[model samples]
Target: MTTNEHINSGEWPLWEIFIRSRQGLDHKHVGSLHAVDAQMAIENARDVYTRRMEGVSIWVVESKHIHASNPADAEAFYDPANDKAYRHPTFYNLPDELKHM
Candidate 1:
C-alpha cells in the first residue's frame, strides 16, 4: 500500500531503523518502515536492510518517539560548548611517556 493509504487507514505506525554493521562500533539510521510493533519492526528491518548480512545488529524505534534538536537552534544549543575551552584535549599537557595518547 502507498504511504498515504497506510496513514489514512491507520494500519501501522512508522518505525525508524538503525543498523550496526559488523565492522562498525555504532548504530546508524538506515531508513524507516511501517510496522505493528517494535518486534515486527526489528524483524522487518533485518529482512529489508540485512539482506547481505552486512549488519551485526538492528535497532528499531517508533518514529514518533525519536526527538531531535532543530538545526535552526543549533547555534544556541551548542554555544555553551564553545566557551568551555578547558574541555578541549589540547588544553591538557600529555606526558612524554603517554605515546598512545
Candidate 2:
C-alpha cells in the first residue's frame, strides 16, 4: 500500500469501525478501513460499512489500541471470567421462545 494508504500498516495501524444498531446495546464491529486521520477513517467507514440504515452510532478504534488475547493465553486469561459466573447474567434464563434476546 502507498503512504497515502495508511499511517503505519504494521505499527501505527489501521482503525476499526463499530456501529450501534440500537440505543441500548454496545457498538459492534461492522468493518475496517485505513485512513490518514480519524476524521477520514470515520467518514470512510460510514460510507463503506453503513451505507444502509444499519446503525445509529459510530465508533472507531486504531487497530493497535485493541488488545486481543493470544491463543496461548486463552485458559490462563479468559478462564477467570468463566469461573466467575457472576460476570454473566445466567440468573435470567430466558426461554428460546422469547422474542428479544
Candidate 3:
C-alpha cells in the first residue's frame, strides 16, 4: 500500500510514549510508535523502550491528542509567562524550614 493509503487505513495510529524509571521521577518522552489501540501502544512502548527493564511505568499518548505550540510562535506564546514574577517563590519570605528550597 502507498504511504498515504496505509496512514488513512486507521489500523495504525501514532502514539508517543513516556517512561518513568522510578516512582519519584517524572515520565519523559521516549519515542513514537504505531499501534492499533492504547493497550497495543503500551505493549509496544515497553518492548521498544524498556528492554533492559529500565522503566517502572509507561504512559502511551496518541500523538494527535497532544496540543503543542508552534516553534515560530515561541516568543509570543511563552513571553507572557516569563514575566509573571509572582509565579516564582522568590518574592515570598520563607521560614527557616522552607528557606532551603
Candidate 4:
C-alpha cells in the first residue's frame, strides 16, 4: 500500500527524532520514523540513528506536537525584534578586560 494508506489504516504514527551526539551540546534533528508510541519511538531512533555509537542521547517528538512559524510571515513575525536594540549584546558597552565580549 501507499504511504498515505498506511497512515490512514490506523498504523504507527510518524515521529520526528532528534539526537545529541557525543561531542555536541545540543540535540539536532536527525530524521523521522514511524512508531507505535513514544517509548518505541525512542528505541527505534536509537537503533536507526545510533547504530554507529555516535549519539549520546535521543529525543523523540510526535510530528503533530511540533509547531513552527510560517516562512511566509517571517517579516511580520520577526520585525518586532529589530526595533529592540537593547536585546542585542552589541547595544551594550563592555569593559576592555572582557575579552569574550
Each candidate's number of clashing pairs is 0, 0, 0, 0
Ranking by TM-score: 1, 4, 3, 2
- At residue 90, what lDDT does model 3 achieve? 78
1-101: candidate 2 lDDT, tens digit per residue: 54444455553347889988865498999877876767878888889887887887889987768898799988888777876777678678898898866
Residue 2: error of model 4 in Å? 21
Q: Candidate 2: global Cα-lDDT?
A: 0.77
Cα-lDDT of candidate 1: 0.88
For residues 1-101, what per-residue lDDT tens digits would candidate 1 score against the true structure? 55456667988889999999999999999999978777889999989999998699999988878899899998989988988988878978899988977
TM-score of each: 0.77, 0.63, 0.73, 0.74
Candidate 2 ranges beyond 4 A from true positions: 1-13, 79-101
Q: Candidate 4 has which clashing residue pairs, if any?
A: none
RMSD of 3: 4.2
If candidate 2 were superposed on the true structure by all CA atoms, what would the RMSD be? 6.8
Candidate 4: list runs displaced more than 4 Å. 1-8, 79-87
Off by over 4 Å in 3: 1-11, 81-87, 97-100
Using lDDT as the measure, what is the rank order of every candidate, best first? 1, 4, 3, 2
lDDT of each: 0.88, 0.77, 0.85, 0.88
Give the Å shift of residue 8 in candidate 3.
7.1
Model 2 residue 23 lDDT score:
57
